[model samples]
Target: MTKNIEHQFSMLVREIRKEFVGNGPKEISTRFVGSWAVSEMKGNLTNIEKFMMGSKEGEKMVHEARTGLVKKIYSDLSVRRKFEDLAGAAILRIFSDIDIEADIAMTIFVFDRPLISKEK
Candidate 1:
């Protein structure tokens, strides 16, 4: 059941990224840790972004743009509501970062409560 939730959550996250960024990660692996859902993604850089990575200044710009954009995108009330409904928990915050050279990104969803139910 938990695995199913993780898969669904990952798909939703991918969809969100594709919608906002016009491209999604080639791969996404998500896991639940307490109240946090951590997703590691690969192949997230677009062709233009890959080219920009060739320069130090361009790399900084890409990093800043992607990181800031992702945070702002997730901060949308509608997006938050979607995640909340799917995860069965309210999202308190979101943390996201990326590595331009590696074409990797990490998104952590911090919930108000644990996503996994502990059986008594």
Candidate 2:
């Protein structure tokens, strides 16, 4: 099941890259962060506990993750806007498939910047 999820995630990333980056030598990268990364980082937390945590804690973590991700994505978008515009949307859509709510939240916050920039 995990393998299938990973495969689906990879395929999603590839499709996003094609839409944004095309077949360029360089690649657009997508990362999962926030509580998801923290939980993975801690390595000892149960999925239930992670999910059961109050919304406040989850929002805080997701905010922090969005800040970091936005910085990185903005830098990438600055240099590769033509090939990375859809990347953020693709990521948000991917998270929608998973049960992790924080992932979607973080993606929403992080994705807005590049999108606004593209419109200008």
Q: Which candidate is the best by TM-score?
A: 1
lDDT (tens digit, per residue) of candidate 2 on 2-116: 3343333344444543444342112222343331210111121235435654687874564454345434543554433422332333222212111234332222223323332
Per-prediction backbone clash count: 0, 1
> How does residue 28 of candidate 1 score in lDDT?
97
Q: What would the per-residue lDDT of candidate 1 be over residues 1-120, giving only the tens digit for each residue?
A: 999999999999899999999999999989999999999999999999888888999999999999999989998999999999999899998999998888899999999999887879
TM-score of each: 0.96, 0.25
lDDT of each: 0.93, 0.34
**Most lDDT-accurate candidate:** 1
RMSD of 1: 1.0
